[model samples]
Target: MSALEAARRRQSWSKVTPEAPTREQLLPLVAAAGRVADHSSLQPWRLIELRGEDRIRLGEAISRVRGDDEPSTKPLRASLLIAVVASYRPSEKVPRWEQEAVASGVAHLLSLLLDEAGWGVIWRTGDYTRSPEVAALHGLGEDEALLGWLYVGGKPDRSPGSRRTVDPEPLLTALPR
Candidate 1:
């Protein structure tokens, strides 16, 4: 599919099947996604593959942070979850914000690629993202920040509907002469 069509078809799938692409299957797509524009070629990001018991572990941590007696079912919504992390690297040329944006671009682009490859996906985040338990679960470093988790699984029988278009009239404008 053309990039335009791919972008148009890519929408968050809140619910998905119990099947997801394996790490071996996702490597190529992740490689392609990593090609996003980075100011100084500083790939200040990494992905953690969480499946099966890993999700359950994360769910437990989330539950604990939320003060819930029961484990959270949020992490179990998908068969696979890719933890998106922004690893901040000090650079004189590229600012921290730009690095973060680069990391975000990788996530968005990967979502598009995953959708094109016939997988259902949604980027999920919560107030507990920065919580101590959650951070410890990912083994995050002091310079790394939890961006979110990309919940992935097989698409349901029904096709995904196109997303609504955003009006650009107010959002885009040319510089004044």
Candidate 2:
């Protein structure tokens, strides 16, 4: 499919399942995603692939942080998940923000690819993204940021519906000429 077609299809995806992709399939998708534009040769992104019982471990961590004695059905919904982490090791040439942009690009590409391949994905982030205990669990220091968690799975027994459109006005920024 054309890039335009892919982008159009991607805009409508929601309701991801718990059916995670195999490691073999996941590795290539991630590689393709990382090939996006980086200001320099500095590869500043890392994906923590979680599957099976490991996903359960993360859900526990999230629940612990949220102080929810009950584990939410949300975590168990995915057969696997990829924690798209932004490891911004500051360098004189590449600013910290640029490294983060590169990371975001990687995550975006990864999500688009997954959605195009007929998999369901939701990029989710909340207060947990900055939780110190959560950061340490992922081997991330205070300087780094948790971009999001890509919850992935096969499209469930149902077909996904139509796309949701956003108003261009709020999304657009008019620069003063």
Candidate 3:
């Protein structure tokens, strides 16, 4: 499928099979996302792959940070979780916000690539994403912050159903004469 078509059809799948691609298979796709636009070539981002018991550990930390939400059980929902971390770089030309934007762009592009590869994917984030305990578990550096996670697994038999879209007329604006 064409890139635009792939993007248009992209949808988040909440349910997925237990199967997932290996690091060897996924690294190439992840590498492709590196091509995302980055001002000053800062490349202010990194990804941590979580599987096996690591998910359980993350769940526990999330449980602590966000009580009564029952998010701890979420880690096990997907076969794999790719943690998106914004590794800020000191640049006079590029501010911190721009760096974070670069990281976010990478995550979005990566999600698109994962979906193209027939994987079920969803970018999950919450208030607890920046919690101290959760950051510690991911071993985030002083200049780094957790953006969120891409929960990925094999696609299920069912469709994702229709997606919600907004009209472009309300969002577009022209300069006043």
Candidate 4:
């Protein structure tokens, strides 16, 4: 399919089946995603591919932090989670925000690629985004931030419905300077 067509067809798939991407498959996906725009060629992003027992361990951590609201099926549902970390090594050449933008771009491309490969992906981040404990688990430095946890799996029979229409003109427009 054409690049525009592939992007337009991308959708948010919530309910996923049992299938999950292997480590080998993820390497290329991550590599392709890392090509996103980086203001200073400072590819300030890292990915932690959690699978097998690792996913359950992460769910346990989430459960510990969540107390009562912890979803019992989190471990079962999220068999593979790709944690996107934004690494901002202090750079005098470029602003920190620009570095963060690079990380966001990486996550965006990764999500699109996963969806195109017939997999469901959900980018999740809450209190854990700022949690030191969680950062330690992912080996994040002081200047780093946890952008999101990308939950991936096969698209289930019943999943989150497609997004409704929105006026394009208002959302996208070039302002004359």
lDDT of each: 0.93, 0.78, 0.91, 0.79
Pairs that collide, model 3: none
Give the least accurate 10-residue stretch of model 4, judged by summed lDDT: 68-77
Query: What lDDT tens digits, residue by residue, belong to model 4 across residues 1-177?
Result: 666776777776656777899988888989999899887788898988877787666666666666745633565566788888888977898888888889988998999988888788888777856777667767888889988788899888774686766678888879869
Q: Between 1 and 3, whose lDDT is larger? A: 1
Q: Candidates sorted by lDDT, descending order?
A: 1, 3, 4, 2
Off by over 4 Å in 4: 67-75, 174-177
Error of 1 at 24 (Å): 1.0
Q: Which run of 10 residues does model 1 get worst, by summed lDDT?
A: 158-167
Instruction: Give RMSD to native, each candidate.
Output: 1.2, 2.3, 1.7, 2.2
Top of the candidates by TM-score: 1
Query: What is the per-residue lDDT of model 1 for residues 1-177, given as tens digits with 9 covering 90 to 100?
Result: 999999866789999999999889999999999999988888999999999999999989999999999999899999999999999999999888898899999999999999999999999999999888899999999998898999999999976666788787988999989
Q: What TM-score goes with each of the models?
A: 0.96, 0.86, 0.94, 0.88
Deviation in angstroms for 2 in model 4?
Answer: 2.2
Cα lDDT for residue 157, model 2? 73
Residue lDDT tens for model 2, 1-177: 877888777743356564667889888888899899997778888999777777676777777789999754555667777888888776889998899999999988998998877788888777877887567667886667888788888887776776676678877898879
Over 4 Å off in model 3, which ranges? 67-71
How much is the lDDT of residue 53 in candidate 2? 77
Give the alpha carbon lDDT tens digit for every residue of 1-177 in model 3. Answer: 888888888899888888988999889988899999999898999999999999999998988886755547899989899999999999999999999999999999998999988999989999999999999999998999999999999999899778977577978989879
